[model samples]
Target: MLAWTGGGVTLLGLVMLLVLAASRGWFSPVARLVAGAVLGLALLGLAVWLHRKESARAGAVAVAGTGVAALYLVVASGTAQYHYLPAAVGLVLGLVVAAGGLGLADHWRSPALAIGAVVGAGLLMPVVTEGWGPLLAALTVVLEIVAGIVALRRGWPWLLVVGAAWAVLYASLAAGVAGSAELWPAGAAAAAVLVVGCALALYALVTSSTNAPAYGVLASAAVPMLVMGGRLDGWRGAAVAGGAAVVMLGVALVPRLDRPVRIVALTVGAVALLEATGLLFSGDVAVAVIVGEGIGFAVAAALLRSRPTLLFAAGFGVMGVLGALALPLPPGVLAGYPASPFTRGGLLQTGPLVTGLIVAVLTVGLAVAMLVALARTGLLGSGDGRAAMWVVTGLVGLYGLTGFVVGLALLVSPDRGGFVAGHAVVTVLWTVLALVLLARGIRNTPLRVAGLVLVAAAVAKLILFDLVSLDGLARVGAFLGAGLVLLFAGVRYARLVSEAETATGPATPPTGVAAPAGGAEQAAGDDGRGTWGPPDART
Candidate 1:
């Protein structure tokens, strides 16, 4: 702890000193540049010595101090016209210091030293280039890629993290530059940075035995790319980013890839694709895309027997359903379909209602298809697959049933009163379906449990909402009908339970068991002797 604190303080003090010196006109720019270079070299020498002497923390501090001094020197050089030269010199110095640290014994090569060097050098590109634009963005990407390669070779995972951070920063700056000006090239540069970062991340995942560092790289690259792409180019940029993410998923699916790597890649890819779909499409089209992707995921999960993927598939499937439900029917459809609940002020429409009905039907059909696929794939043996199957089944069943009732209401009823009556009838239909489920449950436990839950829900609705809102004949019929149904259900349930208990028969004693003392057998066995004792007197 003390070593870490001291190292931190030393690095901070050096930076502050340089900033103070630069702020105050303590030295000429030429003199300051020369002095900074001298100090940076001296720190590099000290780092090498400390590393050899097995002081890893001190060595890391010195290496970081060297990079900072190099950066300060480059900034102080005052070569505005030749700014790239200074940047190059500072980058080289950072590499030299990093190389010196790497040359040390493995135990003494701190990842912090590599991270510091990469960060120091990578951050100088923007400053040297004056501000974020195509040139700076390009340089930063190249620098990060180089740093990543070095980190991979030296087994310094922290350097990969530094590279990822630089990637995010560069991406943000490039996006800002693109937004402020008509620089079409800046967007391309940002895209290049994203690609490089993703590649480095994939390399890290492939080469490194652990997953933690790979995840850092992926999030840093993939997430920022996604955000920047969407912000800059809208759908076009989103498609590009989504494609990159899909590439990562493909890499993850390699036969030799680690399980954790594959899982992370799959999750990131799935989310990116879904986000892209949301950005690129709307209404029923978006829902269709989501449903298709969800079904694909479910199929993959079934094949791989992966729970996490199955859950993700289920989540996406639900999102599709929600999207479908939220979609608006066209105003023209409402204009034509005068009886539609959505139609108001006598402005009937047709397109939206038809479109909505079609979307709902398609959504239900897709859900049913997914359930059937899962079942046919024989995935029910796995807990995850079974859960997913049931989730899709329930969603499709409920949505289909609701849509049917609504469509009937719209078709049969042209007025508000008729719509209300239609809903009341639907409630009765629900109750009848619940009863069917209950009857089926007598043969299947799962069906029985589902039936019970549905019946309970119906009862709750009748007592809580329907009873209070309904009036006139509707109210009377609802109560009377619910009461009769409850009575019948209770009677049937009792009979079923009684029959089940009776079929097992009663318990009986073992056949070899002896009679109790003074019972018939024992009395019979002793009676001859007792009677004979009285017979002895008789004889």
Candidate 2:
């Protein structure tokens, strides 16, 4: 502790010497730079000699690390403040300091020293560049390379975390965090950084011994948005996103890749695809592409049983729901929020009529596909809450459906009459959809639960909103439509139960429970899925 504290204080004092010299005009800038460099070298020489003895090693390494930081900072000050060296020359000198520090740390096997050198150099970059410009962007790329090498080398997961944190921060700034940065340049540099991250991630996966690969893989997967996110509103943004998506997709396609790596790649690629599509195209065409991507991803998730892919599919599906009703947002079909879906409006826009319908249908389809995938693996009702994923999915699908219905009705009539009429239609639609889900019976427990929940919501709306809000024929139609649908659903359910029993046998209840005349109908609990137990319990 004392050694480290002394090293830190010594570095601070060296910084003060430069400050005092500049304030007092004690020497010329060249003399000041030369003085600092000579002192740093003296400390380095002293530390090398002391490192030869076992007793002085800790303090020796500490002094060496502080000297390296001092030299690097001096070079930065000379280039950025004093104008004593060209930017390129100062940066090259900085790298030499970094290399020397790393070689010493490697010889000493000191992870802390290596971290100090890389981080010390990197942490000084923004100050040297005075923040936000082409120079900083270039510097960021160089820093990313340094960080990547540190991450790829043995011993120092924190180094990667620190590097990634800086990468994300600069990428955000470059993207226009304070709106001061040149967006394209920053975004371009961000792309390079993401590429570096991906390569490191892949290397970690192929060669890491501990947690190095996991951190690298996950960071690579997440960095694309930050890197390209600032300029996603432009063609340059599109290029970065498109290239990133392609790279991730290619990585995912590599045979025998680690499962986590493949999953991360697929997830990031799906996002990049959405961003790229939105960036390259406009309006209905983009929505159409997104719809297709959602469906394809969902179906592929079902086939491949990839939960992460399915999660993205789920996101794409919900983005549709948000788009349909993002009312305040102006023109274009989700020309806004598929890539960033949290921008949903208050159920007002429901988008263009055709676009809403298309997206709503896709949302529902994705939900069904998700359920099908979970079913094959018996994931639902397993106490993992996986069933809720599809339930929320289905609910959003219905939300899009309702928005479009009202939006279309308003489009047709543009008055209170249209509004009432839309609600009437939605009431009937909800009832019918619930019945359809219920009709799937014991084989689909999750759907059955969703059906019951939907029916309850429909009943609440019918009593609370429609009963008071609708007038004359609109109110009559809601009540009448729902009643008839309920009747048909009841008869169909009874018939299906009879057939199920006749095809199988008199339904058997668990031990200690007597079979009633109603048999399986009563035994199956409220969901009519026979007590929806965990998967292994059934067999």
Candidate 3:
């Protein structure tokens, strides 16, 4: 009883001091170290106390709980290699304590006590092996793999988190050692884990209703898999092909999701596109991916707005093809590799000019469609909170900016003087769009700020690229003129909005624009025309 009482008091003091140290920032590091030590010792004492007074079964639980804490303190203190002897002693003792704790774990998912022990032990592996780095490195990977697999099977969250951390640690070590004699074995181990882990992760997502956890597991496994495989040309080559197929399939499945999920799933699918195309590292693939994303977004927007699906199909389909054709096709399909079609061969690159023109036409079409949609819908806010203007801004902003870049490059018109003129026109168009976004009665403040900032970026890009070649006088004059124009326009726009708000009264509920009441009843009558009613009557 006395031992138990003393242990509880010590544990409470350590917990209190640790909290106080963190909150007050009073000798924080030292306080933390002392707290860790005291906590470990208190846990140890509690274990001993339990062994004496409790039934053997309860004693086992107590011992396991205490040992895990002690393990952390032991490994943490021995972080530096110069203290190798002390580190080894601490590591060995901690492992012994952890082994006893693992034996006491009553269930597979008993809060991951055994796995935690191994993780604490894994940290000390680097400190122990000064000479045989590769061997030690492989051991760490194996430990991480085993831990990750166990975590998935048992549904232990921390085990998965720790496993990812270890993978990163080992991957960094492997990167430096990859060119050396140790490369083949390390690569093989990584490949094995990648294939197995990824398969498990995909199975979890497809088979289980839970998605977030599945994704977390898959992402952790996939990143290292890509990194390790990328270094081996043969494996990297095969994996890249496989990844492309998966991404394509994922894209096709996006439309099947419910409306909200469709948005989220498509966004994730876009990431797969980036990954697949990025690894291919060809100019054509990059351009295709960017163009595809723009087209896909446009189609999704049309669908959301309840336009005829056929209209989207026809519009985006033609736009996608034209966007692709405008880029000067490399001398051959392979020419698309290394460099994109937008890049100029000389000051007079024909491909970029053609591509730019095609892009410009498509962008103008999209802008028109969007404007019509907005005008028809009016400046009214969404009655449904499920949708918001900011979401629209974000989606459209992504597509518009991407299209803008391609359009400008195309406008450069492979001719010498045309390049400068094209760039200037693009900058002016960008500034105009930015002004529209800022001046429009946007409900979302962040979206408004983003639009203004994007405009500023366009102005900066213009000065940096188009005017850099000009003489001192021309450059200064252009800068001053542009700055003054922006400032005056911004001020005028603000004043107008301010005045409009005052005259119209502060923003009000959408009750004024309610639909007609009993329209259905009137339409059913002999008169085909329905009688309109006041907004209040509609409700």
User: What is the alpha-carbon lDDT of model 2 when measured against the actual structure?
Assistant: 0.67
All candidates: TM-score? 0.60, 0.63, 0.39
RMSD of each: 10.3, 9.6, 17.1
Query: Candidate 2: which pairs clash?
Result: 324-350, 325-350, 327-349
Total clashing pairs for each candidate:
17, 3, 2
lDDT of each: 0.59, 0.67, 0.47
lDDT of 1 at 129: 40
Residues 479-521, model 3: lDDT tens digits: 5555665776688778867887788764443476544444445
Lowest-scoring 10 consecutive residues by lDDT in candidate 3?
Answer: 330-339
Q: Against the correct fold, how does model 2 do in TM-score?
A: 0.63
TM-score of 1: 0.60
Q: For candidate 1, give the lDDT of residue 2.
A: 58
Model 2 residue runs over 4 Å out of place are 1-6, 116-144, 147-151, 159-396, 402-439, 442-495, 506-539
Error of 1 at 154 (Å): 3.2
**Which of 1 and 2 is the better model by TM-score?**
2
The stretch of ten residues in a row with the least summed lDDT in candidate 1 is 530-539
CA lDDT for candidate 3: 0.47
CA displacement after TM-score superposition, residue 62 of candidate 3 (Å): 8.5
